[model samples]
Structure formats: C-alpha cells, structure tokens
Target chain A: MSFEKVEHALHKRRKSRNIGLGAVLIGFVALVFVLTIAKVVDEGDAQRAEQALRINPPKASE
Target chain B: MSDASLNTTTQDGDAGFGDFFALLKPRVMSLVVFTALVGLLAAPVPVNPIVAFASILFIAVGGGASGALNMWWDADIDRIMKRTQSRPIPAGRLSEGDALGLGATLSVFAVVMLFLASNIVAAGLLAFTIFFYVVIYTMWLKRWTPQNIVIGGAAGAFPPMIGWAVATGGISIESVLMFTIVFMWTPPHFWALALFMKSDYRDAGVPMLTVTHGRTSTRKHILVYTLLLAPIAIGTAFTSIGGPVYLAAAVVLNALFIKGAITIWRRDETQAEADGYRTEKRFFALSLVYLFAHFLAILAEAGLGQFGLGGWA
Candidate 1:
C-alpha cells in the first residue's frame, strides 16, 4: 500500500476509536452519577432507620 | 521488519515515572476507591478511621496493580488498537517486563498489608481480585470469548465487597448488593463503548460484543442488561444501608438510565453513524453517573444516619 493510503487508513481507525472512547467516557460519567445519587440517599435512610429503631423499637412477641 | 529492529525502534522512546504510572489506569482506580469506600462506610460494624483509610489506600493500590498487569498482557492488542495504543507498554513508554514487575510487587504488598491491617478474609478477597483481573480477565477470557467483560467484571465488583469484608470481617447482604450493582452494570456500560468503537476491537483481534456478535446484537445486549440493572439499582433501597432517600434517587436515576438505553436501542446504525454516535455516547455517559450517584447516595444516607435522621438500619 502507498504511504498516503496507510495514513488515511490510520486516520479512519483513530476516528472510529475516538468515537468509541467518547461513548465509553460518557457512559462512565452516567454510571458514576447514578451511583453517587444512590450513595447519598441510602446514607440518609440508614440514619433515619437507626433513629426510628431507637425511638420506636419493634414490639416483642406476646 | 525483524523482531530486533522492532524492539530497537520501540526502545528509543522515553519511559519516565509518569509513563510507568500511566500503566495503572488511574480512571479505573478511582472508581474502585470510591466504591470500596462506600462499602467500608456502609457496613454496620465500626472501623477505626485510620485503619479504614489504610484499607482503602491498599485496595486502590491492588486495583492499580491489576490494571498494570492487564496492560502488560494485552500489550500486543493494545499496539494494534487506536484506543489503547498510547498505553505505557503499547506506546513504548514502558517495557512489558517493567509493567509485570511493578504489577507483581504492588499486588503482593497490597495483599499482605491488607491482611495485617484488616483481616484474612479481606486480604484473600483482594488477592483473588488481582488474580482474577490478571489471569481470568486479561489472559484467559479476553481473547477467547465475547463474554469476557461480562464474567470478568466480577474482578471490578469485588473491591466494595472486599471493603465490607474489611469492616465486618465477612460478607453480608448489603455488601452483596453493592457487588451486584456493579456486576450488572458492567455489560451495558462496556457494550455502549464497544458499539461505537467496533473497528478498534476488530483491528485488535479481540472478541468484543461488536466484533463477535455484530452491532445489532450488541445494542440488544446493552438494552437487556440495562433492564436488569435498573431494578437492582432500585432494590438497594430496601437493604440495611437503604431507605427513602436512596429509594428516591434509585427511581430517578434508573428512569434516566432506562430512557437512555431505549434511545440507544431504537437508533439504527445508519442514524448512529450519521449522528456521530450520539445515542451511544449519551448512554455511556449516563452509565457513569448511574454508578457514582448510587454510591454517593449511600454516603449521604450514612451521613444522615449519624445525625439521627433518615430511614435505614
């Protein structure tokens, strides 16, 4: 293959890879966001559950 | 064209500390650290803050070690693929021998120190994580089958469980849920990237979804995984570390994730090509946030618990 043809092919390959990487990076950000939100909310509820159990403990069987 | 000529040419490049560090794949390391920290904090058992810090640091080092080993093994394909070509070994910044040495040293140090500082179970889990990532994922499964990431993702999912083990000295339902969230999330997250980067895997001779199964099958797989992931992500709300706040976050984030997956599924290849890969791009980005938000919500719930508020046990 000619030098120019090889260069063109390399360029095309890089472009495709770039698109794929971009997609991957974006997906990573989305997953991080979802996880972060869940982390924050779960922590909150855990605190409340701790309090609720302390204040209004479960009843024992008669 | 000889091997000597190729080696000589490759050896001419610079290989500094920065280059050596690049082999660790810091982006992936950060995710490992964050999830592991969440697991440590969310556990019902109390751990000394100093010990907790050390455990997390060791876990991060172990994760980095795994990445280096992966780079060492995949150097050949990394050289061929555009995306991985700039990695330390592939870019000729570091030799494969050096990567292997560094990865091996860190792996041993991380495991031994984790065992001393925490417990045997956590140490064993860390060791298995390194072995799984290096042996099962990188060397064995990667080239052999398209299901590589799906199964090998267990290595990535182990950190949080390891962290929980460190805190509690054993696995629990909460830790398992943490593991499950990442396990189910991996396929769709990776497949989205594979969809747009199909040619790289093709060039590298790796059997990724886009290469082995075709783009249509890959897209359908992403949607299917996302469908399963949405429920699991929401189900964490019912656990000991879960409550109303987490449930709310799960509902919203999962809705967005499902919508993104549907958008990806509905788009034809021609449209994807014409739009310069927008749908796949959006879904991939959302997947990152999807994971981070889940962990951050857990942290938030934990913090609220300290103040005698929120609804978790």
Candidate 2:
C-alpha cells in the first residue's frame, strides 16, 4: 500500500503563524518571570536595609 | 490535510501571521520605540536596565495597539485612499473585528504590564496615548475637521513624555520640551505628504488640509508649522537634555528644515506639477530625517553626560 501527502500555501502560512505566536507567548512568559524576580529581590533588599537601620539607628538621629 | 479543510480556511478568510502583524503598523511602532527610548535615557533619574527595557516594550505595544485601533475605525476611508488601501483591514487580509480585539487586548495588557514594571505615571500616559489616538483622533477629529492631524499629532507626541515619566516618575520641563519638538514637527511632516498625495484625502473625504484648504494653503500651513517648529527644536538645546553637540545638530538641522519649507512655500501649483511636487516630496523626506536626527542628538548628549562631558558645566 502507498500513502499520499498534500501541502498548501495556507498550511505553510498557518504553521508560520502558529510558530510566531508560540515564540511571542514564550518570550512574554520569560519576561514576566524576570520582572517578578527583579521586583522580589528589590523588595527583599529594601526590607533588609530597613531592619538593619532599626537595629542600628543613624548617628545623626542620636 | 483535507480538501474540505482547505476550502473552509479559504472561505473563512483566515489570515497569516504577517497579516496580523501588519495591523500594528510596525513603521509607526518604530518611531514610538525610538522617541520613547530617547525620552527615558535623557531624563536625569536613572532606571534599572531591566525595568527600562520592559517599560519601553509596553510603551511600544501601547502605540501599536493604538495603530491597530486606528485601522479598525478608519477601514472605510482606508479603502478609499490609495496610500492606505493595502493596509490589513482595508485589504481584507484582516477583519475589523480582528484589529479591534487585538488593539483592545494589547491596550489593556500594555497598561497593566507597564504599571507593574515601572510607575503609575508612565502607565497612565500610555493609557491616555492609546485613548487619544483611537477615540479622540481617529473616531472624532480625523473626518470632522481640516486641522485633524494638527490636533491628532498630540497622540504621537506623548511617547517621549511617557518614556521620561518611566525614568523620573514625574513630568518636567525637559520632557515637555521633548514633547513640544515632536508636536510641532508633525504638521509640516504630514502636510507635506498631503501636498503631493493631493487627491487621497479628497477622495476619502477626510478633510485633510490639502483637501479642505487647497494645496496653496497646505503649502502655507507647512511653512508656518516649520517656522514654529524651528524655535522649539532649537530651544531644546538649552534644556537639561541639551548639550553643545545637540545645539550644533539642532542649529544645522533647523536651518536646512526652514530652507526646505521656504522653497516649498514659494512654489505654485504649476511649478509643483511641472516637477511633480519634487520640492514637497523632498521636504516630506527631510521631515523624517529632521525629527530622527533631533532625537538622536538628544540621545548622544545623554550618552556623553555619562562621561561628564555632555551638558554645560
């Protein structure tokens, strides 16, 4: 037995479109991940500095 | 896979990826990206590189969303105008619904993302820009008045301010000056194109200056705007973002720009037709370079500022 395959312009364009959309979605996820990490790290550093300042008040305040 | 499936796809008029992208008006998006980046970098406050990149991305997406929305609303006139007939909506490559959906979704997405990545000020400006471009300009002013682009130009001018806000978290004189330069440049740039593409606005009934005011008046308008633009652009040189390098570039660019405008102002229809609006065409081309070089000079000044050699000490 033999099998036949078919191709069309529409299929090629549709495939490309799917791939493009997939790439964009993946990029968006990665960007959001990085942004979240940056924000969390920033907040953590700020909190740590605040705690340190409380434990050792500034000489100016004294 | 099947003949029936192929028939259905063709019948449904499904678009390719490029068709979807075309709805965003990538050329205009590029201008948005450049101006916004310049604005952000020129501000005194420093931004985290990651945050800056994300903010700029959202701003560009917002601008593209507005472009898509504009296409959705102007599909009819777009089909009539020779210049816009090939655009996605008008060309039947994408439906108006597709543009509307994409624009609205991206508008919301960009605003929310910008707020998360930067401050509220930048996000607010982005929201306003999308509204101004889509509702105020496209839906309201474009067809209602000959001075459409004059007011509509504000929509394009906001990016730099938004960019500045992203960095500084507030508005300032420098950002306003940056905004003013683009605001003033738009009239002459667009009117020059209107001069040569004479019948487009008329045929589409959009009330462009050239259509409603006549070519002579359009020429005069271009000259007036160009004259007004020179002082603002040159005046930017004295601002915080401006330096000696910027001043030099502004002086030379403004001089050439004004001369081009004068040559355009002096022409009659007969002369214009004889040379096929060559002067007008050149003026239009120069307008693009004029705006780009101005922002580029500002960027260069900002770069030099890092080395302590930029602004006047």
Backbone collision count in every prediction?
72, 0
Superpose all Cα atoms of candidate 1 onto the true structure and report the RMSD in Å to 1 decimal: 12.5
Report the number of the highest-lDDT candidate: 2
Q: For candidate 2 chain B, which ten residues in a row score worst on lDDT?
A: B4-13
TM-scores, each model vs. reference: 0.80, 0.95
TM-score of chain A of each: 0.73, 0.83
Q: Model 1 over residues B7-35: C-alpha lDDT tens digits? A: 33335223444566677889999999999
Per-residue CA lDDT of model 2 for B185-245, tens digit only, reads 9999999998899889899898898888788898889889989989999988998999899
lDDT of candidate 1 over A1-62, digit per residue (tens):
65432333334434554665577459646644654565466579889999999999999999
DockQ for the candidates, in order = 0.03, 0.49
Model 2 quality (TM-score) = 0.95
Off by over 4 Å in 2: A48-62, B1-13
DockQ for model 2 equals: 0.49
